[model samples]
Target: MDLDSQALNMSSRADLVEFLGGLADSFATHPERWQNANLPDFLNAWAAWLEDMDGYFQNRGESVPTSASWQLIAQMLLAARVYE
Candidate 1:
C-alpha cells in the first residue's frame, strides 16, 4: 500500500483546538444528546477531556487554548497517521 496515495489533508492543530472549544460550548447547552449517544472510545475520551479543559479554563481565568488542547490535537493527528 502506498502511504502517500492515501494521505489527505486534515484539520490543523489550531483548528482542532478551536473546534473543541466550540464543541464544549455546544455540549453545555445540550448535554441530553450525549447521554444516550454511542460514541467511540476515542471520541468519548476526547469529549471528556475537552469538557474538563473548558471548566479549567473558566476556573483559572486563563485562555481558551491550553497546552492540553494542543497535546490532544497532536495525539489525534499522530493516531490518524498510524492508521495510514
Candidate 2:
C-alpha cells in the first residue's frame, strides 16, 4: 500500500471526512489485519479486495490481476472500518 506515498487530496469537507474516516479505520484495523483476528472488517476488506481485483484488470484491459492497486488497497482499508 502507498500509505507513505503522496498525500491524499483532502482540501474539501467531503474529502477531509473521507480521509479522516479512512485514517481512523486504518488505525483501528491495523492490529487485526496483522494479528489474524477474526474481525469482520478485516475479512470484509480481504474478500472485497479479492472480488475487486477482477474489476481492476478489466478496467486496465489486463489479462487478470495478481495484485491490487492503490485505489483498491485504499478501498479495502477504508472499507475495513465498516464494522469497526
Candidate 3:
C-alpha cells in the first residue's frame, strides 16, 4: 500500500486509535522479539513525538491525525526498516 496516500486518506480519530491499538497488541504478543528488535526505544520515541504533536495541536486548537495515522506511520517505518 502507498502509505503516504493512505495516511492522507485517514479522516477519523477513532480509526487511528483502533489501528494503534492493534499495533500495540501485536507488540504486546511478542515482547521478546520486540525487545530484541529495540522496538521499545522506538516506541518510546514515537510516544514522545506524539505527545509533542498533541501539544502542538492543543496549542493551536487544531486537530491532530488520529492514532490510525500513527499506526500507518509506524508500519511505514517498519517496512522501510527505519526501526532497524
Tell me each candidate's TM-score: 0.32, 0.30, 0.35
Residue runs of model 1 more than 4 Å from their true location after superposition: 1-10, 36-84
Q: Which lDDT tens digits does candidate 3 get at residues 1-84?
A: 233454556567665556666656766776664543566787687688777887877787978757445577767667867544
State which candidate has the highest lDDT.
Answer: 3
Least lDDT summed over 10 consecutive residues: which range in candidate 3?
1-10
lDDT of each: 0.59, 0.61, 0.65
lDDT tens string, model 1, 1-84? Answer: 122222223246565456556556656777675653444755677778766877767787977664445676567767977774
Error of 2 at 41 (Å): 1.1
What candidate 2 gets wrong by more than 4 Å, as runs, is 4-38, 66-84
Give the CA lDDT, 0 to 100, for residue 12 in model 3.
77
TM-score winner between candidates 1 and 3? 3
What is the TM-score (0 to 1) of candidate 2? 0.30
